[model samples]
Target chain A: MKDKKPMKSVFKAGAITSEFIGNSIYKHQTKTSIGAHNIFLGQVRADDIKGKTVSAIEYTAYEDMANQKFHEVRESAFEKFDLTCMHIYHSLGTVKAGEICLFVFVSSPRRKVVFEALEFIVEAIKADVPVFGKEIFEDESHQWKLNS
Target chain B: MLITIKYFGQIAEVTQKEEEQLEVSKGSVSGLLNTLNTKYSDLKNKDFQIAQNQELVDLDTELTGAEIALLPPFAGG
Candidate 1:
């Protein structure tokens, strides 16, 4: 259903509310045989590198680019897999370290495709999207995380 | 035409400013970077990247009035 609204990432300081992603997940499912649902949630870890404790993650993206990439990812998934529905939502700003950064949900008529679709969407988001984040540390020192 | 470009993160640090305009024949992204490298040699040795309208682009990608941004390696988890 194209009219079903896609989820918007909760880009804010502190924690992400379930509603941001839950709504989209709810819309994606219908009472069909669709046997499996797979979800991946990415949480920011308080990684301590070189004595710096990552306090928060500030997510940024070129809106135009990211939206385009999102549409492309959706299309590729439809072409590459046998799926019922899929949803991807990534935070855009200030997700505190240890909070959620991204959420991916995939549902399919069969179990096998959900796994493949989950992996595919996650990898695409990491590699192709124009999202950038700054890992802010306790001491306020920051570092960039490469897609690699 | 003079096209204004924006820089973020390490790119801003090196350029010492947020935005500036470059005069060119709406050339390729690589050509612009080359001109910038000629003026600021530090870029030649750094890990900076180019984006046109926020999409990561190859060096040879052509630019035509697109909003350009220079970004260093990302730090998002």
Candidate 2:
């Protein structure tokens, strides 16, 4: 079935907790039409830049445009794949290293559709969405993060 | 024409503010950039793309929309 949900704000103020993620999974049990569920979680990495280490990432976005892009991505995914439901959540404020910053859940009637849809959505977000991240170093310095 | 400009990420740091409205002559995207680059001198050194009405537009595109955004490289996941 085609999903015709309205545009939603995918941003959360802080890091996404495992409890929230687990609860999300728990909430989907009643949707027995979904035979497979695929998830993609983007965690903040403690990357070493030269001599310093990244401690956290503070995210910001062009909110209106980002939400619009997310809507377009979701719509296209539904058109391309047979999915039961899909959800996307991204961190807005500071997220510590090793914490989840993005959670994308896609459920479908088959395993292949979920896998393909999840990848398409994630890649589209990385390339098209106008979300910025400031990587704060352990020493208190910061640098803008660029998706590579 | 008066246009509202939004600066994001590194572009905002150069502009020192996130949003501003400017009175500009009827022109193209590059014309608006020329004005901004003059207003915020450091803007030329930074890398960014331009969006008109939330959609990316080339510099040669005519200035048709009132809202323009200077977007630095996206880092979303």
lDDT score, candidate 2, position B77: 69
Per-candidate TM-scores read 0.81, 0.98
Q: How many angstroms is residue A89 displaced in model 2 relative to the true structure, after the best TM-score fit? A: 0.5
Model 2: fraction of native contacts: 0.87
Specify the poorest-scoring 10-residue window by lDDT in model 1 chain A: A1-10
**Which pairs clash in the backbone of model 1?**
A133-B75, A133-B76, A144-B75, A145-B74, A145-B75
Per-residue error for B66 in candidate 2, Å, reads: 1.8
Evaluate every candidate with DockQ and list the scores.
0.47, 0.91
lDDT per residue (tens digit) for residues B1-77 in model 1? 67778876566667888788878787788888888888777877778678887777898898877778887775433
TM-score of chain B of each: 0.88, 0.96
DockQ of 1: 0.47
lDDT of 1 by residue, A27-135 (tens): 6556465688899888888888987788987777655666777778887887898877776667776888777888878887789999999999888888777677778
Model 2 C-alpha lDDT per residue in residues A1-148, reported as the tens digit of each score: 6456888799999999999999999999988888999999999999999989999999999999999999999999988999999999999989999999999999988999998999999999999999999999999989999999
